[model samples]
Target: MQLLYEHRSPPRTGRKVALIITGALMVVALLIFPPEGLVTTWSLWALACALQLAGVGLLALPPVIHLWITRREIIIHPTGPVRRLPIQHIHDMELSGTEEDPVLTLHLRNGEELDLSDWTDNVPEVMALLAQLGVARRDA
Candidate 1:
């Protein structure tokens, strides 16, 4: 079966809310509390707000992308392009769970570690697929 998935690492929802609120506050400050040189001083803040908004938008793109897994390989399609990695190349899998960050890390035979937590939507499903394909868990 051909299963598709995407890689996405987005700021947490709380982070997004905070960014929006902060940006709004900055906008309000620029409007209500104009500095002596408001135009020049506020321009930088305005630019920063715009950049933050763009980042929020980018964070929303990962769920829309999908990964495809089959007997032969795993395919990850992000916003811009598609990436394919053969099942044979995957040497080990590690599930990273810490107080701060929880992620699934894939270690390839070629000595590459691919972090999938940010992009993968259904991690258990991915784990099942990998297990079925005989991928060993390094952490275990």
Candidate 2:
């Protein structure tokens, strides 16, 4: 596939590693002190577990943080299963929301509309690219 446009977010690997380390330290601290009260111990354990789980979840997430459009498809790089949308399947592109917080909506041929507000901030640029690729906007 021909490369059209790409936008990426900075890496958060270091932050995720730090979170995992912090959670591990919490676990160690709980083991050493064994909180005085039963309720406190349980609370500490819960916190430790939550921290560890959150760290692991973050680590599992995909690193790509923006939309990647090619000649054939629009690849959404978010934490989800439906990542690729074919260009041919897109019926129209629509922009909504306030000017300060614009949202790009993809109206699929099957009638499913995808709100891309959360995935991308470069709304106008993306809209332009899609238009150049011959994907008509809703008004057109």
Candidate 3:
């Protein structure tokens, strides 16, 4: 099968690095100076700091969505999972939203509808690829 279109979201590391630095500094500051004896136990402080850091790290790492469009199917690779939707299985596609921000909804034969806009912002390109594959599209 020939690969027609491919899209990979750019890596976002600047915000992640900044979040780590800020979280570390806050943790250090709290450790150096307690909030007027608000917390008596060091164990609680340590646990709080650990939880805060973990939350910040998780927020910093956003899920990346990648798309591989071929003549036969559209493969969506998100973070750690892969989903392949064959062209034939696509009963129809709905194009909604505004022209500047369009939302592409794929209706599968299994009564499943996936909003492609959630996965990526390049809906126009994906719509074009589907058009090339002769898939039926409905404007909503």
- Candidate 3 positional error at 136, Å: 0.6
The TM-scores, one per candidate, come to 0.52, 0.58, 0.59
Per-residue lDDT of model 2, residues 1-140, tens digit only:
77687767766888888878888999999888787998999998888888888888988876675777898998887344548998999999998788899989999999899987777778898899999988988862
lDDT of each: 0.73, 0.84, 0.77
Clash pairs of candidate 2? none
**Largest TM-score belongs to which candidate?**
3
Ranking by lDDT: 2, 3, 1
Which lDDT tens digits does candidate 1 get at residues 45-88? 87758857965885574444556677888777634587888999
Off by over 4 Å in 3: 13-65
Q: Where is model 3 poorest over a 10-residue stretch in terms of lDDT?
A: 36-45
Query: Worst ten-residue run, lDDT, model 1?
Result: 2-11
Model with the higher TM-score, candidate 2 or 3: 3
| Candidate 3 C-alpha lDDT tens digits along 1-140 | 77787676665655556656665776677668766654654654676666667657766665565777788888888345889898999988999889898889999999999988876778888888798798898766
